[model samples]
Target: MNSTLSNNPAVVIGIDLAKTHCDVVGYDKNQKIVLKLPRISKEKLLERLTNMPRATVLMEACGGSHSFIRKVKALGHDGRLVNPGDVKRIRCGHQKNNMLDAAYIAWAWYIPGISFVAPKTQAQQDLQSLQRIYQGYMKTRIEFGNRIHALLLEYGLSSPQTSRFIAEQLPEFIETHTKDLTPLAEEALLMLRDSWLEASEWEKKAGQKYDELVRANEDSKRLMTIPGIGPKCAGALLTHCGEASRFRDSRQFAASLGLVPRQNSTGDRDTLGHITKRGPKHPRSMLVQGASALMIMADRLEGALGEWVRKIKASGKKYGVKVCAIAAKLALFCDTKDPTRTVNKKPTSAVTKVSGIFG
Candidate 1:
């Protein structure tokens, strides 16, 4: 095993974390082991780190790391969450153990080009909780729609399979067929009707809160200014990313969200793969949905690039390619840019106009 942790001057800590316990390996700049400690309480971990002169703490980005990271920040020390996948790829030998893993995490942080995940704050936690609830309600609404459609198909009665249309016709359809329907079919219809009403109520409640959240935040407003970002998308993104400046660029932000495609190539050969969706699933999903919305309402986006995208779609390329392009563009749009390279432009007549649309 590597034994250089003790002698070096600048100390770095690697923590292999678990639910009830965590292992810490302390190393010096020369890679000598200064300390190899067993499972310790998070409270004690903070106390010990706080007592030290100052050092960098590194751990894998997992569920428990967030709170510890917040504590570490309060102690006036840097806390880095090394992506586990990146760490696995960096190990040089077959002798893998907890101590080596921790040390490697610290080493990875010191290396250039490897990215770290930003810790979420209390505000972000709260926002995520609310968004999850909203998403749950939306899922119920979709299930209710499916049930209603299925029930209608059983009878010779059918209308459009959209939420709005089904909701609008439910009451009238039920009233007209009340006497003609059999008892079992009527029971099923009644259940579907109740579910539909409940789903509508849930949607309204979630929508109201979502709108209020978007309106109350400056970051959400800033995100909304981008083409295709709506209230739900903006609110979710602003809440999830707590600190936009932490991302070095938009591409990093997009990559963090798993928007960029993965690539594996060889000499004189190339292979581009699907997006390595290895980050937070919710926000990445929200951004992709927002990108789809932007693609549909292309006229709302103000830029030559957005206009060009519309032209490509108009030229009869597949809709999927157009969607992927827009999602990639969205990643760039969210990034901070050099003022000299940025310009203002308007949407062209290539796309249909859409009202109340945001980037």
Candidate 2:
């Protein structure tokens, strides 16, 4: 450790993190750079931070950022993950390097109204990882299934649209009509089918793991109380948002998830555009899917939520917009309604207000 760093403890520190190296810049209360450690190993970085006086640590939200924040918090220091965009907005000069980036992060820390990401817990990260794996497997399965369908169609053999149906029936069809397909084509179809089956199994296992995690979590249980949300959807939202209490209100919470529309307004003029699509993709996707399912079963839905859905549909909004509205409404519902206390109670004023917006 440098003498200056050891003697004059920094009030704020910024770290530019990479896979193997980190650049650290520290500022005193006067905003003067007092400590600059360029190119330190992760272990060395932790060791130095462990010894330093507690200070606010700023870093970009990126790979391993949450884990690093956890470690920083454990060391009795304040750790905040700033959005990269926020840092970019406040960045001063064109010249950029690891050390300069760290310095800029330090500067951004003092800027008011800069949004920061909450560090996720280990369990939340685990659930997110599982969800991502499941999505990957699902994509692979779909792609392989599509390829198999196209290949079969080339041979004038049509299979059912269902993945399971295709996976099961295609092999038998190929074996029976082995003469119909060229040897190369027959072998290729069999190989693709096998890959699809494997991917499907992996997808199923990942989904089961996700469900088990959701079922074991208390927050997820409460989230599942919403009409459209199930175990998977609830798990996604809980893991993505971490804590709903961080949001000032349900509307802000919904907007954070990008379920709300973008707005541009001037005196006497206002314009609303499409859904921002700005947050974690998985959570937004899950919410939209859940809301769409509820819309499909709108006739069966009964209550203020059902009535709101009908009103939106009758208003002749595009189908996608209606679904986004429902998703935003659902987020508001989840944020305001406590399952433990309000599970049996009627819809509250929050729900009414949300419905009024769309009504």
Candidate 3:
């Protein structure tokens, strides 16, 4: 410990959480640095924190940070997680190191109006873990499918569009094309097909796991009530957002997930660009993919949501633009509807308002 001269106990401490070690900095009530310990081993760090007087512990919300926060809570300290991006904006100079990052994290808390991230409960993290596993399986399935498609393309044989269809038709197609494909291509195709089959099966199981998680979670169930938002989308949204109360309103929630447009506005003029795309990629993807489903069948949809979708289509925007428009609207709708799954029961006004702008 690079302990300072003052004897008063620290009232605030910032920790730069690394995988195996952490850099820690502390400040007393008088805004004086009281403690500085760089590259402390994880075990010794916990012991140090446990012995210290109760103080607000700050750390960037990174990998393992939440679990560390839980441990700190067990030791009877007030633990807070700050966004790493926020810390960067407040950080001093271009120079960076573990100690500097720790000091910045602590000072970031001292700065007024800096927001804090809500620490996810163990249960939320568990659900999110399952969702992440599902994402991995899906990615594997897609990757293998693409490889299969490319391989078949090389042999002048078209693959079936869907994974299940491809799995079923592959053998017959291979037999029929035996005269065309080289032995090496046949061997490669067979190997890729088996991998794709394994991945597709795992993907289905992962989806089933998602359904199991959704069934157990009231929030996920409520979210699934919206058309085109299945267990997968519901799971992704909950995994990313955690809770609706974390946000002030639907727009803020949407903006938090980067569903809103970027702005480069001057006093005299306002300009907006593409979506910021600033948060977790998976949830935003689920929203837009679900919106594509709704857009393709918008005519069959009814009520305010349908009307909004239809009007957006009527505006002659491209499919991609329409899907994003609907996704943003859907994000807003999801925020207003979840947690209690009450209040803002009808999305008519929100739907009409956003549709009018985009349409």
Candidate 4:
């Protein structure tokens, strides 16, 4: 790791990061390649950047990019995480390598109208990790449950629809049907049932941890004030949105959540389509699910939100579209609040205001 490059401080530095090594390229103010370092270890890369004069650092938004940006910022450099798609659009030539990608990332930073991804805080990353863990556990549990159900069906046995039904009634069902099933088939069913039970327990434990994480975060607590938003939904929103203030207004915020409609227009003619579905799917799905839950209980809602829901229902739009529209509205409502505002105490008034609508 040479310190000469740091002492000279290029105008912009781009990094293409991988698990074990990073490709780095630097450009001077005139867009000339002033520095090139390929396949540098993570520690070496950090060492070379340390104590460097402040300069802009750019990287494609990818796994570990957030953490890398944090390191660069600590060294007094401005950090920007550009979307990979944006970088790809600007990349030149068909032949691509880490060095070229890094150079492209730096050039992409200077492109007009390029969108940069906000670097997530450590806390946000932690919440996202918890959410991913919970999702993984739930997915595995469902797969196991499905396998058990299919196995039983193949043997002419019908299982109850309830989630816990298999765990509770499996032993009895197995015993009674042992004569009907071959020894190997019976053993496989029992094994699958046991695996399903284990997965269910793991899923429950993950859910508890996710709830605890959300409850401990102040942003998540305030998010829960929104109608139909529970700990999981709140956590997902907080993790994804980071700071509501980043968006200029509620509409932009909702669009970032992929709640806004896609547009296609040419020569004065206009066409609108479904949502672009551009962002993380989990939080977007969670918002839609929350909106659906709210619609299910709309009769109990009394105020503006409830009335709005009724109006949408009366409009004759498909149920899915209505849910998406409401989810967008909910996102806008969330964006109206300041993320930095201290809401250490329970959000009683906020909850009451929302509850009043339903009442």
Which stretch of 10 consecutive residues in model 4 shows the poorest summed lDDT? 350-359
Over the stretch 1-359, how does candidate 1's per-residue lDDT look in tens digits? Answer: 22323444447888888888777888776666687766776667777777775788889988878888888878888887888888888786557887678778877866888887777787677677678778887888788888877877777777678766766776677778776667788778768768877977987897788788677876666566656667877766766575677776667777777777788999988887777886777776777787687667767646675676577567675676667667766656653554222314533321212111111
Clashing pairs in 4: 300-358, 301-358, 302-357, 302-358, 303-357
Among all candidates shown, the one with the greatest TM-score: 4
**Candidate 1 local lDDT, residue 29:** 64
Best by lDDT: 2
Give the CA lDDT, 0 to 100, for residue 229 in model 3: 80
Q: TM-score each candidate.
A: 0.75, 0.90, 0.87, 0.90
Over 204-226, each residue of candidate 3 has an lDDT whose tens digit, in order, gives: 88878778977787666666766
Which runs of model 1 end up more than 4 angstroms from their true locations? 1-10, 87-107, 110-112, 147-160, 164-196, 240-242, 269-278, 298-306, 340-359
Better of 2 and 4 by lDDT: 2
Candidate 2's error at 5, in angstroms? 7.3
User: How many steric clashes between backbone atoms does each model show?
Assistant: 15, 0, 0, 5
Better of 1 and 3 by lDDT: 3
**Residue-pair clashes, model 3:** 0
True lDDT of residue 340, candidate 3: 37
Worst 10 residues of 3 by lDDT: 350-359
Off by over 4 Å in 3: 1-5, 155-158, 334-359
